[model samples]
Target: MQSNHKKRICIVTRSLSEGGADRVASLQSILLNNLGYQVFIVTILNSVSYPYKGELFNLGAIKEKNDTILGRFNRLLLLRKFLKSKKIDIVVDHRVRKKPFSEYIISALVYPKKTIYVVHNHAIDLYFPPFKWLTKLVYKKSKAIVSVSGKIQNLIFKKYGFRHLETIYNPVDLDYIDKQKIESVTIESPYVFWYGRFEDEQKNLSLLVDSYNDSKLKSQGVKLVLMGNGKDKDKILSKVGELGLTDTIVVLPFSSNPFPYIFNSKFTVLSSRFEGFPMTVLESLACGIPVVSVRYDNYEDGVLKHKHNGVLVENHNSGALAKGLNLLVGDEKLYLSCCENARKSIESFSMEAIALQWKNLIEK
Candidate 1:
């Protein structure tokens, strides 16, 4: 007979960073903890940026400072033994694996069952060659598969022939964004904001900078502030300088609370190559800022409803994006219309709403 008590749950993440998935992982743990579940966050690394309301286990901290063969094996064994002993009801796996071998091995050993893999990308393109096939096979070991957006679920079904999959959009902690008033780090200028990891390949920041440069918006003294740091920061920054846009464009490190900037800006912008569902767009809407973004593949399927709430460029061309940006921000009536209807568009993605979905999945 099942005990009438809180079910123990664990969320496994690589680390907490500015990445959309990282935010989702930490937010889920906090939500579940608040929902009165026995929650645990098992992070592979110690660099946690977000605060959570559950027990946190930093696997990195337990291992010896010096890397010895035996020490590494012992740590792995310890992790497996610990989880087994605790008898976790479920393990929510949120790490995106670039390679299949290690993930498959770990799942077979530590997560043989009762594990749910949360896919957070345009899954098919993120992999290479035969490993993609192997990765799909590895996912079979999980108790269930969840896609961050419906588009990802469709891709997985078509490619891997998976029968069942759940599409759960990333949740926005509305209470935190609403109540955490930021009195500091205010952007006085009426600017168009863009914030995300500085990585260019997937995020397509190069296109955003070029499009911003191509547009005459910068001439109006409406600054373009790009937030979040990554390995590609210096390269993107150098490009910003090369295009003679250092003064017009600004790059800032990720802020713990970016709502004030989003709420005050003329509108927010994005130019991602692809996204699992785009937390930035959802967060931007939650803050009541109209969005302007390229119509990446998954863009249409989620967050962006075009013209209704935000402007969507037809293609990724700089000229097209520039024209779209100028149209959205330059036209007073259109921007006002979008801003008025912004928050209403994403009410379904509120933290509480998404948490209900997760709760249903967990209890099922």
Candidate 2:
């Protein structure tokens, strides 16, 4: 590809804050730029710093004056005009189109020659009823539909009747993850680390916490480390306090870099009820850390294999999660095997490899 003749690619999203989709957008922009593509990121809300090392253009913030009838129409008008003026070759929209109403508006107004919609959630229940008609119309108009996992693609096809969707697993930048020379942090006893937001319901933190509290692992000094802040932090903290796990559990906020913790920890745990291929699993594997995840449709097949890279527990089962954690932390040989396998498993999903995938797809 000629450097100067590089295609102008724009990624449009609601925001660039901490999330898997946002991170993917940033990484794609950086990788595409390195491959000699002129990239621009347009945000409809919140000005988030471009997390990728590439050229980023913010197309002004979304101005919502009030909840008046004219106000809504004016905002849509502004967005439509902005889309027309950009004259970009491709526009990739990354946002949930739950209701057909909004999808209809976006399809009718912001018409691009090649518009791609990337779906990152599997909640089919939310895409029906009030906006059923609009939803079908928008999907029909979409040039390409991208899902983060095969599970999501299947859900879209089976429930929503969209068969043309493509599955692209989230990519990790192994190059940026700093692997520390320090040997794993020596804990006097084995510890089970859960490094993510404290939202007990969605993240299923309570399941892990209750399981650990009632397991033999607790008697053996298996500690739970909770990282990342959220709306439910206070409730989680209170629950921990009530359970008298203040000494056994630790809660921390989000980190700009979470690799050091991943490196020091023995193993990572993901307890999400649902996911669109989480980047955290990829990040943990890149750092040579094993993971124990709730068996989700996509993640089980993609990341957590029986004993290969990580362990997959039955979904929403505290006992299963606890058992998986105990096995990894208690059995030294199994832990080592899992760590080694995790490191090897992530080779194909590295940034360079994924960039080539994106390049081939875009150029096609």
Candidate 3:
């Protein structure tokens, strides 16, 4: 029999915005709640208005005025007080500090016995001074450190000399995906689809656009479909126009649910320069869609096995990405084979299996 006392699991993040960490935290909360745990979400911002089916209680909201130095200190004090009063069983901290020094300070002050710090990125090279020291301190203080990718885990472990880091690949709700029947939308034209933000530097969108325009695939009916909004959208769109790809390329705003388009597209493409286990790739595979990605991280290796499950391109090379896309689109048998393999690869990442993993972690 399950214990009557609900395990109070508190998830602390910066906000419930439409980012990968926010999505992961939300999914975790839903799964934990289904497992009979009382899930509390603590955030510093208050822009979230999306209806969450799971039971989630928000702590006192902090205004944007608290974004300054003293404001951050006050927020930390408020968090500490809240933790003390709530008597949370397990506190999962997912805050990626804007300033590295604050990481150490925050870790030192928030001394919850059962605290888990989740590392979501591998690009810690940009971390500011005192931040490195703070990160090390937090790593030492954390009861457990969870990395979204093995690459991230190895990087952090090597940097901080922490030996017991755990790698948990971001999970996808496969059941929800399976329920989404492939829509009967006609492919008006054969095209390669890229459904993520136009963050050129991070997503390597510029490289993707240049490569696609240069490729022989462009002569064929293979246009590039760009989706998702970001700070760099206008710049990226202007570049697309400059390349005379305005007709060949389609730019879309961000969607709360991108599955419908994913289901109807020829395949999914990821042009990221770096990723800590991309949620888009997992979500695409769960929808039984083939993917073409630039291999920059170890997690990409797990998802796209060259031409087996999906195509893997050389990092920062637009030519290789374009060639890979062309090969997949040209070969009908290969396209079907890759999509089938992608669906199978995502079986382990199903919600039930991931939820079981979470349950084991928390119960242990």
Candidate 4:
């Protein structure tokens, strides 16, 4: 078989910030580049924070006065021209098609010929509200649909008839995580750690604050560490202050390497309302730390196997979520059991294994 190493590949996404998919795109670019392919990341907003091995193609540089109708049309048309001129082979896009007139939809218009759509969310309801028909149109034009989890794949096909879909779980760079974990770090206390954006809509971060504020863990001198940033950062910080947890709740900035934080934490906690497959849980487990997370489609299956690897909260409410956190952080026997199985449970999702799946998809 002739090798495709000399072939050019492009990954299109809005930016590498605020979410896990962007991180996945960055990791994929690095892995593909290492595999001898010429990889290029085409980010609309140049907001890249994650590490990659590819040359960046920032379309956000070519901007106008504002995002007017004419401005959008010009950007879309020019982007199409640029993609065509590059003669890229197999563009894999990891962005949600927002609307009929958005950049995502515009790319969907041009990418079907050479693009495989990677769906990151558990559902596409965030973007499709008034124009639900656009969902069908976006997928209809996709060469193939790659869901991050089997549950997400099933959810997509169940709503919209069967299509060319495949489930490729997110890749966790275990080597990078392990290397970072050993690099001496300092955390004053054995805190209950939670990271990712402060978005209450998806992550439901307020639940964490409420639960922590009311929990016996705080009275016992255990701290709650909140890291990462987003649009709702100020609001969340303010909520913590209002609840008089300004000292108990420690908020830190977003980090590229959070393994050290996860390594030293008592146990990780997730209060997400919904998720495709959270990277934090994967990374925490990879570091031999258990997680107490809200029950979701992906978390319960192979990772947090309900007291096997980590405890699963049956409800999304603050009380239920707090109880799960307390169980994992407070109980020594169960916490030790979860920690014993944590690293072993997520071995299949390692970057080495999952990268092969991506290689097959890209070559196909």
Best by lDDT: 1
The better candidate by lDDT, 3 or 4, is 4
Candidate 4 clash total? Answer: 0
In model 1, where do residues sit more than 4 Å from their true spots? Answer: 1-5, 62-75, 125-137
Where is model 3 more than 4 Å wrong at Cα? 1-5, 49-61, 124-134, 180-189, 299-301
Compared with the true structure, all predictions reach lDDT values of: 0.79, 0.71, 0.73, 0.78
* 1-364: candidate 2 lDDT, tens digit per residue: 2344487777877656555667778777788788888777776565474376544445444453354667656666766776667656777777655555555776666657577778776654433325555566656666677877777778878766865677777788886785442344433434556665556666777777777776677677767777776678898888889999998887777654667777777888887787777777888888898898887646644766777878888876778877888787778888889988988888889887777777766776
Greater TM-score among 3 and 4 belongs to 4
Off by over 4 Å in 2: 1-5, 47-50, 53-75, 124-130, 179-191, 197-199
TM-score winner among the candidates? 1
lDDT of 1 by residue, 1-364 (tens): 1223487888888777678887889899877876778887887766678767678777767653635767766766766876777778889888765555555667778773788888888855443224656766766666778888788888888887776588888988777887653444556676899987888888889898889999979878888988898889999999998999888887889876677788778889988887878888888898888899898867757777778788989665899899988998788888889988998888888777887788878777
Return the lDDT, model 2, position 109. Answer: 67
List RMSD in Å for every model shown: 2.8, 3.4, 2.9, 2.4
**lDDT, residue 339, candidate 1:** 89
Residue 63 lDDT in candidate 2: 51
* Candidate that beats the other on lDDT, 2 or 3, i.e. the better one: 3
- Looking at candidate 1, the ten consecutive residues that score lowest on lDDT are 123-132
Q: What is candidate 2's local distance difference test score?
A: 0.71
Worst lDDT 10-window in candidate 2: 180-189
Return the TM-score for candidate 3, rounded to 2 decimals: 0.88
